[model samples]
Target chain A: MAGSELTNIKSPRVKAARRLTKRAFRDRDRSFLAEGPQAVREALALDGVVVELFATAEAETRHADLVAAATAAGVPLLRASGEVMAELAQTVTPQGLLAVCRFVHVPLETAVTPGSTLVAVLAHVRDPGNAGTVLRTADAAGADAVVFTDASVDPYNGKCVRASAGSLFHLPVTTGAGAGRVAQHLKDSGLRVLAADGAGELTLDDVDLSGPTAWIFGNEAWGLPEDILALADEVVRVPIHGRAESLNLATAAAVCLYASARSQRTAPAGVRRPAPAG
Target chain B: MAGSELTNIKSPRVKAARRLTKRAFRDRDRSFLAEGPQAVREALALDGVVVELFATAEAETRHADLVAAATAAGVPLLRASGEVMAELAQTVTPQGLLAVCRFVHVPLETAVTPGSTLVAVLAHVRDPGNAGTVLRTADAAGADAVVFTDASVDPYNGKCVRASAGSLFHLPVTTGAGAGRVAQHLKDSGLRVLAADGAGELTLDDVDLSGPTAWIFGNEAWGLPEDILALADEVVRVPIHGRAESLNLATAAAVCLYASARSQRTAPAGVRRPAPAG
Candidate 1:
């Protein structure tokens, strides 16, 4: 194996790192961007994470343990100059290190365990940042899964990936067609489907979230679609006690998911029902 | 008072509106930016809003009732073209409507209600979006005030303003120096000060948040400073069940504030602390 030190701009290793700026390179090459020490650490910690790791000479010396772990995992390493590293990096201050991680597809089915008490379904959420933050919150609240419905932002978008803070790797997330179908399936499977809306009939505090359930968060611009709302057994809302017309979409999702998690915690343990006669 | 329609490209009114893109214009004029029908409705609903209301001819016609209300409230009105409106708009899709609102200065002393049971003291949070969302969440969770100590984003920055939805209007927020001194004062006034940290000894859910209290949220990059942490009677954290390193600053604030609110709700009516005593 060639232990190439990429000193020049034209080096093939340096050129490959620069391609991460474009989506085509990220998709066609099946490699994506991860920046900053914390993010790089997260990517390193995950199994099957590194395809190619890049760092400036200074970062290589400073984060020797990190580089060693990647090398031990049989990952290819690229050393670039600080200037080159900065050019290849996404964030303003790159910390002189980055990684091109192989994207792992999260499974759609079985993402939510049958015994899980709460799941979050995002429908037509266009903003990747909002979608990713919701996924992170769901992970924080220990929700079983996050389901992305039709027309939603791709969870794999760079901004979304960064926003998830690697929670994307931890949570069971299902993205694809027919989120409505999944909602129906959860309902038929005996999970309560609660849709979140500003004009919802019941406040989130007023809803019973102790049972197996799915909470739906909709588009930041439009709130939930009528079809999704119709599928909901009950509609719940985060009470707006102040003059803010609406909370940001991500904030709203965090509050609802946390509230549901709290509700479940406070409820009697035996309240969870057995799976409805298969 | 000339009745001539204000349609010309170089009209003084149109030129003045265009100047709002400069912060000095926004400040010196004692007016800031607001747009879209929804934002306008919330602003109009709030007291002490809208010094000047600007809209395209079509917007004025489409929202005649709103226009009438603005005129009745003695707000100055300007008519501009869609192209002209975009000059003052922050978003990509200009709503063909905008409002120049008077900046409301909330006094810190007044914001700290005489007998409030809970509030949030933000220390050195620099992100405008994070700061504004914190204020909005504090409002939703029914906290008395959001206090900023030391260097932090201006709570009224356009991005912060937009992020707050209309919460900026309703919530009592005061910013200035001596946050630590004020926090100590809060403790002396019989309020518990809970500081959130990633490695805190106590879990947020385990803390007794039902008492009169002021929760402090710190900068996103460094968490709370040691000096500020020293003032906290209790340091608590939201236990992370996933691999994500930490929750977003606003999301963390919401979770903490809501947990406190939840405990207050579940407490025996008599056991909960009375409003803070002056």
Candidate 2:
């Protein structure tokens, strides 16, 4: 049912949606805000839970397709005032539409189970933008899943969601797993956990990526710690042929994931070629 | 020479540095601000003009190497108060160091001269962060130069500089070129002009990138216009094997440039294989 126009900024529904901006409130409710037309549209199409959607009259007209989709799905759609929409939005320029979506991340066991050929693991990645970009890149590279260690930034953060640009809804993401636990789970499952480090002895060009692999990237500033590095089966560095000091976390992850994706795609079917020894 | 401690934010030197935060001031003075130890250190090492340097006491102690470099270069290094540094920095968390660097961009003719091998041209790219990230990627790929069309964001923007990390100093950059002129100049210089478009007929995987090439990328929102796409020798799109709606400006550019870099590196020496006919 369509709710009455929510004019008051402090109305119960508006306030509830606004509270989702806080991590604690999102965790308690198991919901996060997916703002903008692109994100809201994607969330509405997913099989995951989309509790409610809010839009201003302007948005109702501008995003008529999304509104039609919500109505077709029999989901509750609320008409809100500009002030209420702004109050619910984290960005300075709100995109007029926002959806309250339940956490869609799967368990680590489900994400890294057998037959998962490629995965991305972020360890202590503090920047929300970098974390989100990595998720988007991994999805584009067709990685089976992405995992975030407990030390990493919250994937559900508003900025992180914005950076993902709708890819967050396209793939399964597992979060809050311990670095060591993830390494062990992947290894036991027969996947090689390769840590991306600048000082690694093995270069990416020299490493064979034909086998199942889990790429572990680290914090934006400090990169992977020694303890975390020790947990991986191998450590590899992207070759720096130019004078650039190093690639940032997101770009580095993109190159590494794409490399693996290309290798896996071109490898002959049913022939398990051994990876070159580091 | 070390200037006296600049405690007063209103002092002429400090005020001039602060004004550099504005585009008008930067363009008028032909100077831009390079902040943080990494950028400042790079600027000091380059042949580009370093008009002045400023650091807080904490930064002086923390970045003793930079101080010594400036001292050896015979450049004036002013000691400023934290207040002064903060006022001069655009970032919320100032890095305690800043450098006034004269514009180092070359002309289009100079950037894409006869011997140039690989280059990236951005056509009407509006986002400063995207433009900066592309510049860094191009540098890392060992592209000879990067050219920004007049419609693109200013390379000297503080946000753009920060996104480039230290790459803005690593290679020659050119700005204010028209898309048509860049396409023609590159073509005349024996470089193939390839435009990256989502709707392109040619896939990046199928195209041969073994020769000198100039890659043309478009705006973040509306991609290259039909006229701009027609100007190129061929229009190519990165194959999206996954369900991503589309790659962002930066990630797409990285994939394309790295593809070229890899191809050029692997091609046999002294053999110029003709690219597939567009």
Best candidate, TM-score: 2
- Candidate 1 contains a number of clashing pairs equal to 2
Q: Candidate 2 lDDT, tens digit per residue, B36-94?
A: 99899889888647888898988999999998888788778999999999899989998
Tell me the lDDT of model 2 at B181. Answer: 84
How far does residue B239 in candidate 2 sit from its true spot (Å)? Answer: 1.6
Residue A37 Cα positional deviation in candidate 2, in Å, after optimal superposition: 1.6
User: Would you estimate the TM-scores of all the predictions?
Assistant: 0.86, 0.94
Q: Would you list the clashing residue pairs of candidate 1?
A: A244-B167, B115-B276
What does candidate 1 score on TM? Answer: 0.86
What is the clash tally of candidate 2? 0
lDDT: worst 10-residue window of model 2 chain A: A269-278
lDDT of 2 by residue, A217-257 (tens): 99767979999999988899877767788878888888888
CA lDDT scores, all candidates in order: 0.77, 0.87
Model 2, C-alpha of B75: deviation from truth (Å): 1.5
Fraction of native contacts, model 2 = 0.56
Q: Residue A23's C-alpha lDDT in candidate 1?
A: 64
